[model samples]
Target chain A: MIPALGLLLGVIIGLALQPTVPLWLQPYLPIAVIAALDAVFGGVRAVLDGIFNDKVFVVSFLSNVLVAALIVFLGDKLGVGSQLSTGVVVVLGVRIFSNVASIRRHLFNA
Target chain B: MTQIPQTPEDGRDLDVQPSTRTAWRRLLRAASPRPTKGTLLAGVLAVALGFAIAVQVRQTSNAGLEGLREGDLVRLLDTVNQDNSRLSDEIVRLEVQRDELATSTDLEQARAAAQQRLDALGILAGTTPASGPGIVMTIRDPQAKYTAAMLLDALQELRDAGAEAVQINDGRVGASTWFADGASGAVTMDGRTLSRPFVITAIGDNNTLAAAMEIPGGVSETARRMGGDTTVLIRDTVDITALRPLSTPRYALPENQASPSK
Candidate 1:
């Protein structure tokens, strides 16, 4: 339930920021949203396991933000923003498909 | 016999408690997750907004294109008009300068220099004074399909052959005069309407200028090609001083230089 909530919040952030964001950063906004959702899920899992570390959460959050920004920046500087967006979308799409498939397999395995 | 489990002190089990309606609620909430719902809505709205902006941008760009075309046409016309005005002004200035120089003390010196140049070129300036002994050619072609531009070309050729003074049937050729079709289908010269069978009178050394015109592929030949009538009359001395000088140029040089050459 919490993970679903986090996904909802991230999507809302993406839509709100789309217009204000520059064209170069557009591709990464969706990626950032999804990454944030995953981070929330990871944090929740860590808490349940009684192994939650503040340093790890902060580091992961900061790295995700920086990496997204860097990819967009480099794409813009190389004059390949559109191509980079295509690559990012393909990778994220595949990841989502695999994750969903894994969940489906686990649920039906028994 | 059964044993009851005790609650943990840290409240972990309470946090994970599953109520009777928990599964149904989670499924309902998952089906309409916030991120998915928000993103879908935003994507649809963004597409609509982009469509509207694209339409507006296209319309604005089209308007700008039309405005630029009109501006270019206006600029072209203005440039042509300006050039016409400048040429007229320059002609007037030259005429005034010529008149003033004629009366100056330097006139005699310049005349001597000109005479020397003419002598070197095997030509005499004042020997004949370009008077008498020439054929007057009057060309008239009212029904002919020739244009005024063609007639102007002939006139130019006549002048180049050393015509001292040339006049059309009703208008004297001048610096500012343009030969073009008038509104009524007849040719217009110097803003005056003229009919067919235009008579052109030239006064110069009859033998020399006339012989010059008689050369092959000359004015007579060109007129023949245009199906116009050409008449050349040789006379000992044809007095033709009734022609009026062209109007005072619109822009004359200052009065300081109006003296005739010595």
Candidate 2:
């Protein structure tokens, strides 16, 4: 409950601030966001499955974002940034969809 | 024959089983570590994700000017330079006219001759608006194989057809216009990257232009053979709204005028 309240507070504060991201980091932000989305859905699925470990969740979330951005960065260096970004998005999007499907089943039991 | 039970499942052993879902669930269980209590990690991630999404959305919405790449910036600067040169030339011409009026004993004849020359030069130099019956052609590349060379060929074909003025998409073509290969199988004309389904509008004699382009063994037929489509329409009047900048000659003077060094 406390964590959820903290999350809500953070969201409100972030929205209110409306901070602009730095130009250098703009390219990576998109992949990072998609990775973060995948993690969010996974976290929700874990919570429903009674396996929502704090360490695991934090580690997975950080790893997802980091690995995704890293792949895109390396792709840019190799002159294939868009192709790699698409790959990352495809995998993450599939995972997110599956996790969300499971979450829906858990919620409505349908 | 084996007697099937009333229930969906039969007593006899079957190859297919309904336990695949359970297996998948077990796999999920093995992957996710079970915790005694809910962690703060999920909340933190949720907050970050929300913030990032909001920021990304806003950024994309405001990305019009900022999204231009280095090449686009260079092209923009080039266009600005051209405009600057054109305006300065006009200023110099006006100043020259002022000097002539002040110095000349007969202003009326000189003014009339200067105005006539300016009018004629304006048309030849593409500095004035030209409107007449012309043709509009749509060229579409279904397979991204159309290159800058192909575009040049088409432009030449139109020129050969006596096209006075031509505009492709929004960029106007002048005598010195050239096409360059753009990134990702695209073509760039006059510093602008043209998208698929290039619409070329040319101002000239409608029937002659159409006949020249539609001649057997022509650019249109070649485009069709290359897995592309071409549609040509001869309109009564098409506006040629593009202006070409005129650069003043510095080192080169008229043949009659002697150089300072000489």
Best by lDDT: 2
- Candidate 2 residue runs with Cα over 4 Å from true position: A1-4, B1-38, B67-109, B112-262
Best by DockQ: 2
Residues A20-93 of candidate 2 have per-residue lDDT tens digits of: 87877887988998997787678766656655667888888899999999998898788687789899999999
TM-score of chain A of each: 0.55, 0.88
By TM-score, the best candidate is: 2
Per-structure clash totals for the candidates: 10, 0
Error of 2 at B175 (Å): 34
TM-score of chain B of each: 0.43, 0.53
Residue lDDT tens for model 2, B1-262: 3233222222311322223344346445544543334444555566777777777777888886555434566899899999999999999999887777676676886888889989667756667767889999998888887889988888888888888788888777876677999988889987789988888888888888888777777778777877997899989988878777786668877765664432
Give the Å shift of residue B166 in candidate 1.
1.3
